[model samples]
Each structure stands twice: as structure tokens, then as C-alpha cells.
Target: MKAAVAAILAGMVIAGGVSAQTAAPAVKEDFKPSSLNQPGQQFPQVNSQGYARFRIVAPDAQAVKVSLGLGGRGGTVLAKGADGIWTGTSEGPLDEGFHYYHLTVDGGTFNDPGTLNYFGSTRWESGIEIPANDAEFYALKSVPHGNVSQVLFPSPSTGAQRRAFVYTPPGYDAAAGTRYPVLYLQHGWGEDETAWSNQGHANLIMDNLIAAGKTRPFIIVMTYGMTNDARPGTLPNFDVKPFETVLVKELIPYIDGHFRTLSDRGHRAMAGLSMGGFETKAIAPKNLDTFAYIGLLSGGTFSLEDVNGTPGYKDKVKLTFVSFGSRELEGNRAGPPGQPRADPRVNAEALKGAGYNSAFYVSPNTGHEFLTWRRSLYQLAPLLFRD
Candidate 1:
């Protein structure tokens, strides 16, 4: 049970969510405001080296600390200056991509007033972006865009209206007779349907890929994965039945009925990140008739024996896509007590050797953060529905 809980929590903070490092070279002078900062807010800045510098104004506070740092400091302590502004820089560089952080001002938790807040770690957190080398793939480009519309569908099983965001590719409505494939994407634990678009930039990634003719246009659906029930102390006995019913029995039918979708199994796919990836592994493989392509991003890995045990998976499944950040490979890869750690890259190779359309990817210098997922989606989108 201890190992099980460890495995479950690993998805939440793989390598400690932008883990700290030891000493580093002298801090460079090329600091600029983060791209995610609010209008006219310039205190939270990121340098080219991924080191974050924070400035918080607290005239009378005893101590102000930003919950982003390196070298096991747990956070960066700001020193108050004559101007009453507390400022400090991270000990070393942070991981490239999006990270959720907060402020500890005189022992009180507060969100940074300078940047946008994103839902993470079960609450709204201040988001910071360390510019990535391949950020262009998910950047807002001058290309055709997709519409991410909020959709509320009835859920008789749950006796409430569940909400989902559907991303219809550009020119979807303009092309009336044309139909597109659908990928039922999910968010990680403590996140809602908004994470994919707001943080992960799913729509923009797809737009860039489609405009470049790198991928076929498809509809992407994102919804709450019902993971709130799997909170601390309850995760060991977590069940996927509630969400499976809402998705397979309720949501899928509504999407097909309302949108111009290729409603067959071959044209459908499911993928998620972290705990969302775990949910995909739980729900997609068991219902192979509903999902043809499966993607797990930093969720977990699947072995040959596991696939062989799943009924009808050999004949019904099309693609098994698995990916993780390079940093995650250095962290805990263990499974529940007796189960051996299955190297995901090796498993991908094994699946390929057995005539399965398996693909694996690793984001350079990242952990289980949004950058890895963004890159994974960029790579996975081009390979989806290639037939």
C-alpha cells in the first residue's frame, strides 16, 4: 500500500515539481518579464538561463518568500530594500516550461499579483513560464486558430450537468460535410478542463501543427477526469467507474451527436498527462472498442504482459503512445511493491517488436511538467489517425 501511494503521488510531483539544484555559475544579467505576467506587472522575471527573480512589495512584513527556488532552499527568501520591495533570485536555474508557485509572505500564503493564476495543486497558483527552446510548437502563431467552446452535457449517472471544453479545428463549421477525428484529452489531478487550453495550450499546438500540414485536423475534447475523489488518504481505493460511465456512456454519445465527428472507433483517441495519463491507462485500454489510439504522458508505463492480458486489445487498439520528461527517468520508477519497474522506453521497443504501433518520446531537461506534455502532444498529434 505504501508503494501504491508513492506511485500515485509520483505523477503529482515527479522530481519535486522543478526540483532544486546545488551551486551554479554567476547569475546572468539578461532578465526579462515572464510571458505570463499580467499587464504592466514586471516583478516576476525570468532570465535566459531559467533562473527566476521575484520582487514582492511588503512594507511591514517580517519576511517575504517566493515558493520557487533551487538548491533545496524550498523557496527564495527576499531581502527587503529601502524601497520596501523584497527581491531575490533563485539559487540556480529551473526547468523549462510552466510551473505553479505561490508566495509565503510573513508566514501567510498568497498568490503573486503580477502573473496569471492557474489551477494546480488543488488550488489557484501563480504561474511562471521559463522560455523553452521548442516553445514555438505551442506558441501563439499567425496561423489558423481553433475554437475551444465550453460544453455542458447531462450526466444521468452522476445526476448533474458535467462540463467539458471541445476544440474544433479551424474551418470546422465552414466545412459542413467534412468530418474530423476526436481525441478525448483529460487533465491531471487538481486540474479541470481548462488546464489543457490555458496552461498546456492544446488548441494553439494543434493550430500550428495543422497549419503547417504536420497533422490532420481533429476535434479535441477535454473534461474533468473526476479525480477529486482520489484525494489524499482515499487514493488507495480510488475507482474509475464513475468517470468511465460519464465519459464512455454519456459524453462520447453527446459529442458524436452534436459535432461533425468521425464517430467510429478507428477515428477516436484518448490521452492525458500525469494523473490524467493514469486515468487514460485505466479507461482506454479496457474499452478498446471506444478508443483506438492511447497516449500516456508521464502517467505510467505498460508492459507486454499487461497488454496481452487485456481482452481484444491486440485486434482493436491502433497506437500506444507513451512519453515522459528526461528528468522523470532519474526519479522513482518503481511500482506497487512486488511489481518491477518497467522502463517505458524499453516497453515501447518491446511493443514495436511485437507488431504494435508504439511510439515513445522524452522532453529534454524537463520533469513531469507542462512542457513535457506540450512536446508530447506535438509529437503525438502528427502520428494520430495516420491511416
Candidate 2:
């Protein structure tokens, strides 16, 4: 159990933020407006090689910098041209998928006017998408889609009405008697409930997966993890008991009562990313009779000892899914002498060898970001609710 907790902490530190950019030998000239740009605006462009170019109209500002590329160098600094426009290209190509960034102009932070804003880093920041090779899996297609409806449920524990987004699969309303399994999904720290649908495209991923007949249709419930109270740098002191009560005690019952859900331990699962994963680790193992399947995406892993220590984990838990970005694993691969690293993959293998249904995944060429979590969900959805 200590090793699993250590691995979770290590993952939080090593894989929780922006990745360092790698330098490219040459820049390509085939830059195009990013798909995430404003309707008619053009400026934040991405090239075929994933290099991002920025053009900001901050004429009077002494300097402009973008908070998107190359760690240790602060960020990419933009140069002012005669037209009073600041322009610059990233030092190298960025990783594929969505990235949250803001402009630092004369020591003031702001969002770029050209691109659309996304809620991240606890605020609305400019977002850009570097096209991915496997992007088609989550792409918008002509296939039947699901509905992501906003639901306001009573939370007596929190003394307020909490908001959650529910994703009902295609034909959910049309099929009268067919009840679906439910997966309670969660987001990372410094993010809200919208991160899973807006930033991660979780609904689209499920839509595509179901359209392809790859996975069983299920309902997904996403709500705030009640983490906003934890201000910058005081996360370790944050308490989970309050949010746990809101989720396990209040929200789960509300969802079961309202939605046409298969309300049983075998049909219900819980998974989260980053700190949300930490919450799952803290909550699910203790409430073994509530959640049968568990997943941690770029979150943490379960050691054999951790599983053995729990009272009914081996008998009640159906699946233990753990995932990380390939780069996140690289960051946790080594530790100083006498301090052995707790490798999540090694822990997963130990669980499997001990006659447990454990699965481990790594997103290629990514870090602790939305793309990693997106791919993790893509891999995990098929393995859930197999009964």
C-alpha cells in the first residue's frame, strides 16, 4: 500500500504539467490555422511538423511571450514587427493534441485573442491542437452521436445543488427498457468537470468507439471533484472526506435514482486522471462494494501488497486499470540510490501474476496532459463492464 501511494505521489510530481519541448533541426513552411482557432480568425497556426506559430497584436507592449513551448527557457518570446504585431515560432514541434497556454505580455498574463479559450490551470486559457495521427478515433463523424446533458442534482452534504454532465449513449432514450452501466469519470487538479468533455473529447471518443462496435454502450457521469478550494501549492493538505461524501453518499444515489442505470457494484466503475486518480485510489478501495472496476489514467498504480491489504478487493473488484504517458514513465523510471522507484508497470504485472485482472497502458510520445488521458480512456472503455 505504501508503494502504491508512493507511485501515485511520484506520478503527480513527474507527470502533472506541461512537457519540455524538443528542438527541431528545421522549420516547415506549410503552416495552417489551427483547428481550434476562432471562426474566422487566423494567427495561432500549426505546421505539418507540429511547430506552432504565434501572431499577437500587442503593439505597445514591451515584450510578449507564449506559455506553450520549451521548458527551462521560460517560454517562446515574440518579436514586434513594424506593423506592431508580435510574431514568433516555437523552438521545436510540440506534442500532438490539446495544450493550454496564455500570453505573458509585459509581465501580465492574458489569453490569445485569435484562438478559442478552454478552462484549464484554474482559469480560461488559450487552447491549441496539434493534429494527432490517431485523431480519427475521436473525430466528428456522420455516425449516430450521444447527448451530453447538464444535470443538477441535490447534494445535502455540500448544502447545495451540484452540477454534473451525463453522457447517454446513442439510442439511449429511444430504447425504453434497456438500462446501461455507468462510469463515474473525473478530471485532474486545477480543472473543472468540463475538462473531460471539452478538453478530452470523452463523449466523442465514446461515440466513435460505440459506432465502431468496439465497446458496450454505457453512461458516463462527470462532476466537479470539489477541488477548487485547494489553492495553488496547498494540495497535500486538501481533504477528500467532504468531496467523497458528496460523490459516494450524495451524487451516486442521485444518479442511480434519475438515470436508467444498472445500479449495482458490477455495473458501476470509477476512474480519474491525476489528482482525480488520487481520489479514486483513496475512495474506491475502502468502498469496495460500490465500485467494481477501477482505473487511474496517468494517476497511479496498485501494488500486490496494496491489493492484499484490502479486505474484499480480490473478491469484489473486477478490474484494475492503470495508465501513463510514455514520458511520464520515463520520469519515474529512476530514483536516487537506496530509494527504489515504485514502477507502476511493475506493480501492475505483480497484480496480474497474483491472479488479478490488472491492465496497464502507456500513451506514446506524450506527457501528463489531456492527450494521455484521452488515449487512456480509449483503451479502458473496451475493458469495462464486460459482464
Candidate 3:
């Protein structure tokens, strides 16, 4: 009887265990898609030498491709692995510069969920930092860095206070007795004062260039190019007149008053990109007494006739520099379509014909993008502040 009871007890324990297992919930069959893979998973890595290799796992995917741009060869790479991992090796050397790239999983734009962002450019999650060589335009170097200060001051033209960013050169206070020339830099469409220092890397570029003795030491004043009543990103309701008034009357006076500036056209200059380029042409010609040097990057609506028509065009301005990318026009081989294209060389010839001393530069293999502008700023900086 006791042996019979022991067997029954063991059987009961086994039955309870089975019941517990059966009562538990089943795992869900359908799972939501995730932007990133597991942490241990590896992706392509490239360096200044322009080499890249990516390890992607896409078990359920029939085909996977890696889209490359900027620092490396820009094309689609096919997946090669079988255990749900797609792998591809880039061909040839990549361009020695910062590039934006993403993954095309079955022709879908997917930013890598694992990597950190460079911010402002909003290109993608994953980015490869390319080291600058002698051949590169602006290489990173160890230099005494300057700080960028964003300040909001009263604007009498707009009636509402606006924003502007000031870039003081390294050792600004150390050179206490020294007053610096100021460059009033303006932003193009879809950008503000933040654009230059952010995507343009204006501060980093200036810091590196100044350290390398590539550019003259000066202060960069970046302000909102839009009018007071103007909506952000869209063109303002008023013409460029309000913008000009804001800069000349309110913005410049505020900056000059607050910061130690030379306060004359000889020690002051104006420059901008796209719409700002148009502003430079409009304001500098009329207020030649305010701005001596002018630099236009990527876009301008002025023709030789316009310059000739403007009052005091010849005697007012000292030097003019116009620049554009070789791949600026539509269907250009250097860049994608829909970029602004104005031939600086042609513009220079016209300006000379109009009795204005001008120089033009077209960077090879660049488009109407920040890459071109950054390089343009580096080149134009040295030419500034020179007697």
C-alpha cells in the first residue's frame, strides 16, 4: 500500500508540472520591425584612407544594399552573407571628407539605429570621419579654439528683438588692445545663424584655418537674414529692403557697439550664401561706405547691367569675390539635380566689364552644397583684411 502511495504521489507531481507548462502563454508570432539590430552586430567602418566594409544581418530580406556617399565610393552594394547577414566591401578609395550615407534595405532609406548623429546636417545616423590630408581643402588640426556666442539683441527695424551669433577668434581677450575686422555672414534659405556653425562647421573651419595660418583673424557675426514679420523658412513679405535696414541700421550697430570692432567699411565686410548672396549685391553696392569687401557663395541674381545701374558701384566697394561649385547647374556630373548654378567666371567677366574689380573661383567636383561653401569660406578668409 505504501509503495502504491509513493507511485501515485510521483505521478501527481509530474501531472502538475505538465499542467503548469501548458497553462503558460505562447510567444507572439508577429514582431514589430526595429530600426537597429542587436548591439553585437557589426556594420561597415571606413577611415581617412576611404575604405569600407559592412556586416549587415537581414535574415528575412531577399536583397540588401548599402548606399554610400561623400567619404567613400557612392553606390549600392549588394548583400553577400547567407545566415541573415549582408556584407559588402567598397571599391577604390573614398573621398577624403565628411560623407552622409544610409542603408537601402529593399530600396528603403534606413538610418542606422546604432550610431550617433553629427546634428544640423540631418543626413543620417551613421557617419565616417575622414582625416584631412595635404590634398584636402580644410583638414582638422590641433589649434587654440574660439567660442561661438549666440546673443539676442534689439532690432529697431523689425521692432522685435532678433538673434545673432558672434564668433570671437582665439585669444580675443588676450589681444586686449587689438580691434578686429568683422565679417557679417548671412544664411541662405532653410537656415539661420545656426546653419553656418552647425552644418557649415564655420567655427571648426575657422579655428583650424586660423591655427594653420590659412585665414586672417577676424570676428564672424551671423544674424537672421529674414525680416521681422517674415516667416521662418519662407521668403519674407517685404523686399530685401527690410533685411538691409536691419543689418545696416540695427544689427551692425548693435554688434559694433557690443564687441570691439574697427567700425568702418575698410575693417568691415559682408558675405552670404544664396539669398544672402543677393543681399550682399543689393546692400554693399548702395552702402559702400559701410562694407568694403563682399563675398558671394553659390547664388546671386545680379547681372553686369544691374551692377552698372546701381549708384556708386565702382567707387564704393574695394574687393569682390564670387564663387560657385562646378556641379552647380542642373544635370551636372559633379552633383545631383536641382542645385543653384551661376557661373562665377562669367559673373566676374561681367563685373570687370562694369568697372568693378572682381575675382571668381569654381571649385572642381563640388555642387551647390555646404561642402562647396565651407571650402569657399576657407579660400576667401585669407583674401580678407589684406591691404
Candidate 4:
């Protein structure tokens, strides 16, 4: 009877162990189908040749377009599978420089959730870094770099403080015995002193050009062009003449006194874009004793009549470089259907006839865009400060 009881107790213990094992909860799967909503998962890796296949997961959208400014537009890509993934290939052995692109989903502007954003000079958090075959233009080389300082100098003409950005060339201090020429660069409408460095990439462009021995080592001073608080694209309430005076009388003197600059007309140059270009034309010619080289990129008062009619205007200037994007002609001209307005090209030709060391460069297939201006800057720098 005792042996029977021992067997029954052992069986009961075994049964309890089996019940406990079966009662344990099963391991649950934490995976969710909605976690695949990320759009970047479809982006293709950019190759060293600057070619990349871009993909977007907008399965719900009917039409998707990629607006590549000056880099060529991408084809309409369709969504694939039930996952709503839209995929397209961009074949670009692109230019060896930085490019900006955005997505247009059914005529609406949208930043790529996956790629990087380069609106102006500031790099946004989202962007894909593309390695270039020869990134000397955009790459950070071992060459000596310069410092860009934003400072306020007292303007005697205006009796107010004015802001200017100064760029000291590499080895400026080390080469104490040597002095450098200065370039007064002005910004266009709706932009201030920071426009050059921020949007124009002036510092990088200058550094790269100097590193490649393409441009002479010089100082660049960028200042605000507009003096009045006028809405952009409209005429200002105040005249820009005072601002020009501030530059010539106050800014130049202060810069010369503070920095190691060749403080004479032979070593000084002035150039600008749009309204700034107009200022360059208006100011530089009037003060020919102060500026030797003048560059007008995209917009300026280039009329030969204006220059000749202006009092005391002569061939006192050394070199004048004029450039315009092809697309700007349409808006710059005005006339009725029967008779078209005078083209600025005629003015450019007249300047050439006036025996000014003048040259006009027209960028093909480009509009009044920053790309044209940036390219113009790259080409124009080498021509400056030449013996």
C-alpha cells in the first residue's frame, strides 16, 4: 500500500509539471506592417561618377516630378507594387559641383524625405553626399584657407554704421611684406551683405579658384546694396546714391586703414549683380579714379549713351566685363507687337565700340538664375588684377 502511494505521488508531481509547462504564455511577435512607411528605404546609392537613381515611396500620388534646377529634369516615375513605392532613375554623369533638387508631387513642392537639401548656401539636415571624380571645385583641399569676417564700420558720408563682409586671402598675414588688391562685390535686390557667402558661395569659390591658380589672391568686400526698406522688386523710396558714397568714402577708407590693401585705383575693382550691378556701373564710372576694373554680372546700366552722356565719362577705366544669361533678354526689353524694344546687346556692342576694354559673355540655355551668376563669378575672377 505504501509503494502504491509513492507511485501515485510521483505521477501527481509529473502531472503538475506538465500543467505548469503548458500554462506558460506564448512569445508574441512585436512586428507591425505600418513600420515600412519610411520613404528613404527606396533611395539608390549615388555612384562616384555623380550618377544616382532616386526613388520615392509615394504610392498614393498619381504623378511625381523631380525639379532639378539647371541639372536637367527627371522623368515621371510611377509607383510599384502594393507598397506604394515610386522609383525612377536619374542618369547624370553630372558636373563636378554641388547640385540642388526637389520633388514635385502632383504640382506641389516637397523636400525629399531621404535626400539632402541645399536651398542657398546653408546645408540642410536631409541630403545625400555625392562623391565627385574631381571635386576640386567643391571639395575642401589642403590649400591655405581665408577668414570671412562680418564687421560694422562707421560711414562718414551717411554718418551711420554700415555692415560689410571682408575676405582676407590665404597667407595674408604671413606675407606681411606684400599687399593685396581688393574687390568690392555687391549683392542684388532682396539680399544683404551675407548674400555672397550664403547663396553665392563666394568664399568657397574664391578659395578653390586661388588653390587651383585660376584667380589672383585678393580681398573681397561685400556690402548691403539697398539703403531703404523697400519691398523687393520695387523701386526704393530713397536714392542709392548715398549708399554708393558710403562705400567709396567711408568703407574703402576704413578697409584700407585696417587691412593690408593696395589702396589705389590700380589695385581696386568693383563688381556686382542686378541692382548692385547698376550701382557698379553708376558708381565706378563716376569715381574712375577709385576703381580700375569693373564687372557687371547679369544686370547693369550698360548703355553706351548713358556712359557717354554722363559728365566727365571717358576711358579712365581699365577693364569692363559684361555678362548676361540668354533668358534675361525677354524681360529686359519692352515694346509693342509691331516694333520690338531696343535690345541690351546693342548697348554692349556700343560699349565695345567706345574703345572700353569691354567683353560680353552670354551663358547659353540659362535664365536669370543664380547658376549663371555663380558660373560667371568663376570665369570672371581670373580676368581681374591682371598686369
Cα displacement (angstroms), candidate 3, residue 173, comes to: 0.8
Q: Once superposed on the true structure, which residue ranges of model 1 sit more than 4 Å away at CA?
A: 1-5, 15-23, 71-73, 331-340
lDDT of 3 by residue, 1-387 (tens): 122112212211111000112232433323222112335534445433445556666788776665663222345576666577776655434443444456778767776543433332223235543333533444445779888998888987668988999999999978888889999998665356776876567888788878888788899999877732443323323377888888899888899888889898898999887556766766787888899898887645345766677677677767788876555532332211233334446768888777787877776555555666777788788888886
Worst 10 residues of 3 by lDDT: 11-20
The sequence of per-residue lDDT tens digits that candidate 1 reaches over residues 1-387 is 334344646545553244455556788989999999999998699898888999988898999988876622478888999989899988778888898889998899999999999998788999999998888999899998989999999999999999999999999979999999999998888888899999999999999999999999999999998887567656757687899999999999999999999999999999998778878988999898899999988877777986988998878888999998887776454344345556889999998999888899998878778998999999999999988
**TM per model?**
0.95, 0.94, 0.67, 0.65
Q: What is the lDDT of candidate 4?
A: 0.63
Shift in Å, residue 218, candidate 2? 0.2
lDDT of each: 0.86, 0.86, 0.63, 0.63
lDDT by residue for model 2 over 1-387, one digit each (tens)? 334434444554343233454544678899999999999988799999888899999789999999875731467899999999999998877888888889999999999999999887789989999899999988999999999999999988878999999999999999989999999999887788899999999999999999999999999999999886676446666688898899899999999999899999999999999878878988899888899999998777788988999999999999999998887777544232246667888999999999999999999988777889999999999999998
lDDT by residue for model 4 (1-387), tens: 122112212211111000112232432332221111235354644444444455777877877765542224343353455677776544333333334456778887677776534432122312343343333463457777988998899976766888999999888879988889999998765457876775567877788999889999999999887533544223423366788778988899999998999988888999987656766876887888899888887654356776677554555666778776554454422122234344557776887787766767775534444544666687788888887
Which residue runs does candidate 4 get wrong by more than 4 Å? 1-139, 156-160, 236-238, 330-342
- Model 2: pairs clashing at backbone N, Cα or C within 3 Å: none
Better model by lDDT, 1 or 3? 1
Return the lDDT, model 2, position 293. Answer: 97
CA shift of 29, model 2, Å: 0.9
Clashes of each: 0, 0, 2, 4
